[model samples]
Target: MTTSAMETAVEVEQRYGFDLIDLETVRYGLIEIAREMNDTLTRGSFSPLARDIRDCTSAVHMRTENGWEMLASHEGCVQHAFTSPHIVNFTMSEWDESTLREGDVILVNDPWRGAIHFSDLNVLQPIFVDGRLEFVLHSTSHVADLGGPIPGGFANGAQTTFEEQLKIPPTLLYAGGVAVRPVFNHLLENNRTPNLLLGDVRALAGSLSVGASRLNSLFERYGLGHVRASGEYAMDLAEAAMRRGIATVPDGDYVITDSLDEDAIVAEEITLQMTLKVRGDSMEIDYSGSSRQPAGNVGTAWIESTRAIIGTKFILDPASPVNSGTLRPIEALLPPGSIVCVLPPSSCSSHTETGSRVVNMMTQALSEAMGARGIACDTGTSGVAVIGGVDERPGHEGSPWGSFAVPGGGWGGTWTSDGVSACIVSIAANCRSAVNEHVERESPLVIWEHELMPDSAGAGMHRGGAGAIFTIGAVSTTVITITGDRSRSGAPGSSGGGRGMPFYGWLLRGDGSGSTLDPRRAIGAEPLFGVFDENGEPDPDKGTFGLGTTYMGGKVSQLVLQPGDGIRLIVGGGGGWGDPLERDTERVLTDIDDGLVSESFAHAAYGVVLDASGAVDEDATAMRRRDLARLRDQNKWSVPTACPPAWNTATIMEVAS
Candidate 1:
């Protein structure tokens, strides 16, 4: 802060009988408290999704004249950063603030009321000091199962939300420091894994108690008014920082359009368009020209705004504190009933599929507007695979088991550095991929291969990160449901760079042969599901009943796998930032040595020539690059404005072939 500003802050602190130094202490103290709450939830949770992958969010909110305002949120899922506010706002609007009491916890999972899907449950606790409401603690986590026809909550073939799973609005799970038996028992009866779900809920609730205790300690040390004002001041600072960041971008409208491979129910393409409008110190994200809701599970609501703020922070003001104030400068214009903002009865079990694409679209538009201070697109898929079945292990026969794996992909390249390889998707802030050991221990599946793909990254001056390949073999009969995108069209590159390869899935047969998955089918046909022949044997050309094998797509339904059968997922690479031929020869050689790029790709995409000794032939490389440039100009090779990367000479697909 400036000297004059510091003086004013001191005066304000004196007027409130607070210390100016305590503002910074209280600011960081709230964040530390949030982290403690997150650690408590993760340590106490039972589900692997929460305990292992940490697919949950924790935050501390202070009550303001404008309702609950986010003060401190741990680095976690960008989707859930705003879910707390949405739930708090909904709860206060439904019931008067005076109706809320200490030791009472509100539970909700309705997507329209701040949840991403039915699988994610949110718990809210109101913290009262001296019988006056001062703050609220919020936590959310994904559970193993919520009694639906499908094993996991993601019912890819479902046409409506009712088919997805149970929907719980804001209801009291705890009242007067006691568990609400009816509400507690109702959730258990509806979930397949009742024991685990109960444990997770208790963990979330327990974490809130932990937060309440810690926050109370802070209030006990520094007066409640000073502590509360510190949180509000933190938010005000974030708002100012965000506004300054927005002002840095040139005033104009930046727009980009992205698409999903298919809605898991049908083969129709689902498209989403996003526009970033910046003027002065404020911005507006408009999701107006998006496709209508489809008859499938890949839909999202409220999360559109969440992804917008995430995108803005990631590209411009990532250092600012994530609170209501940081989101104050941005206005989100989401057309109701659009894919980005679905209405009632629309299934959103796999909303992350669309939510990830929203962030990618925003990144592309904002990066383009920022010129050199930008990055290309990432793999753009959550790369989530839900596998479940009956446990046939010793002493656990007939028991149900499920595994949720997020085999993350590559990140986009930037002007100064190459993208990160084999990392979690961009939308997930601190999520991790499922470890091979954990996957094997949780389910009856053995991970066979987990390696980086060669020649997968988009070629450029700084190449995009390479993706990964994950293959697993089923020891017992297993059913798998995969949700992903960027199958047909890979992550798009920028500034004349080559596009990254697209994602693909394959069914490994008993005979060691593989059948490619069609990136348009929800699932294979019935009777055999395109995995077995008419005689119930693995067929090279087709599955049972003469139905073509490999009919399932990126977003698939229940595909049964026999023993010795396996599935492989090839996550696409991130997009490059600049021209491929302009890449340094040594970097190209380094990529080849590191097994990220093939020797053929170096020659084809980077136009780099290596002699017999595996060293760069400098003179020949310069001539080759010149010739490649001439050919590119003659062929009018340019990145498409509105389409995905093509399988032509400009992409990495050529070298792969």
Candidate 2:
């Protein structure tokens, strides 16, 4: 190159350095800001998901030619942020820079315009340096009631997106450096929990301001040019790290397939298939043969699934930087209208419930292709939250209000160890249910019992994690809504591991009346019913199916508990690892004493002979394992069909058992 051009290039790099650091600093700063913003909403608002469950995300982005580059804070959520580029392009085309003044903001909850769902409100503010757009600060949070046909806005049977709730596109809610009262008033007037919605919106807007302020400060310290350069540097580092990580896996072609129980809304079973081709240091994920997206179904996009699996791997190995560069060697082929590439205007409310199943299927397929190397299926699914309304204080105005709660589920078992019990897994790992004490304080409900269910995990050489049980009572007459999945079936096991228990929910009455609640059903009623539990031996006496239970009302009072009204919740367990016969006898004995694994299960599943004192018969256990191994080898089933030619004993055991 010419001397002048070379000099210019060097200057550009130095200037971009400050911009890069500023970008990254602002990215992390947004996370802390988001937490504080959420805290303010929880303390100031009335929504159960916001104040109690905490389902929200906040982020910042740097403007790029295609759109905004997701700079930081994809941790709070995975769905919306992945589609942020689309949102940015649409917004800029629709609104001019002159329209976005300092203190001005834009608001949208339109799924078509790049939102996960209507319940999640996305707020964006333009950050300017010297009156030119430099970055965008954004936040998204789940509002309990959005003036929907259903109190919680999760209308399961709604045929159209409009029936689900309102759709707000990129409207200039606040302009000319002022709060737009008309827009705020319209939102409040349309919702049951006006105060709560307003509070959440404010919280979202506040987070954006915080991010903008942090960006401005960074700009002053290092200059915008250097900040931009740092982003490029970070991307380069991330790419290098990801390439190195991919090199660890053996180079070859591996394919895996998984399916959904049924598209609840569509009432049809769907398949999600994936093929991973790793050649040297490069990898490509092909989703060509996946099922097509049904009309009006929104859960078919493969990008989210691709990001989720890749993101999970990145999380497991943080030494790998997260950026498009890390994804450079990775390519995805999602057919149009496939489950992974749903057409616009499709119902995607069930995306999380079904998307999780897709992730498991991919993991399962990968495990199969890789011969179970560096992978394991997590608890099949993250349990759903059941929420509704309750009536207390007969003489009081607005005596009825909404409430909700989520139950935990089992983690997946691994080749080396059992799954962790009652832990949320995969993409939704950070989500948590409401604390019992807090639930009682905020709503007219009483928590009866919240404990781990015994022996619910799959039994094998490495046992899975245990599920949970929670019972609650309504202080007064109330109504509630329920939404979630993984109740009908549990996650599948690997090798010789057993399947984790399925999840369930039911309703119990004071008069000894009870009924089964469909996992896909969303209903409203006084004295609502809810349950969150994994599958296990059924109880004929109480008529408990072992999934979950929730009750809305049994009495009438003002946020006070009365006798005879309650709800029950149960979480599921993870799958086990290896054949039970291969489990250590001493380990089985210790499990029996610790109440993790029952003596009967130890004896039956693992072939461990335990005496009355909980001591193991080592000779018998050894003989049983030897016999089992011999049988496996004799049948030519001791190794996986896809095992490499250089496979070893451990590899054989992992693939076979």
Q: What TM-score number comes out for model 2? A: 0.80
TM-score, cand. 1: 0.90
Task: Return the lDDT, model 2, position 461.
Answer: 65
Cα-based RMSD of the predictions, in order? 5.9, 9.3
List runs of model 2 lying over 4 Å from the truth.
Answer: 1-48, 78-86, 265-268, 279-282, 294-307, 310-316, 319-329, 394-397, 512-567, 624-657
TM-score for every candidate vs. truth?
0.90, 0.80
lDDT of 2 by residue, 20-41 (tens): 3454564345345445544554
Scored against the true structure, residue 408 in model 1 reaches a CA lDDT of 74
- What local lDDT score does residue 11 receive in model 1, on the 0 to 100 scale? 76
Cα lDDT of model 1 by residue, 1-657, tens digit = 211224576675765456768888999999888888889888998878778888888999888888888999875565677566887777656756777888999888888887778888889898988998778899998888888876667788888877878888889999977999999889888876787888999999998999999999998998888897788778878888888788899999988988887886776678899888999989999999999888787878787776767778877887866888888888899899889888888888888778778878877887888888778888888778888888777776887877887777888888889988887777786877766797787678888777787767877787788888777788888888878877656788766666676666666655543422322221221221222333333221223211333544577778888877888777778888888888889988988899777677678778889999999999999998888788788994443211111112121112122
**Model 1 residue 15 CA deviation in Å:** 8.5
What is the lDDT, from 0 to 100, of the residue 379 in candidate 1?
83
Model 1 spans with C-alpha error above 4 angstroms:
1-17, 513-549, 636-657
- Look at candidate 2 and tell me the lDDT of residue 76: 41
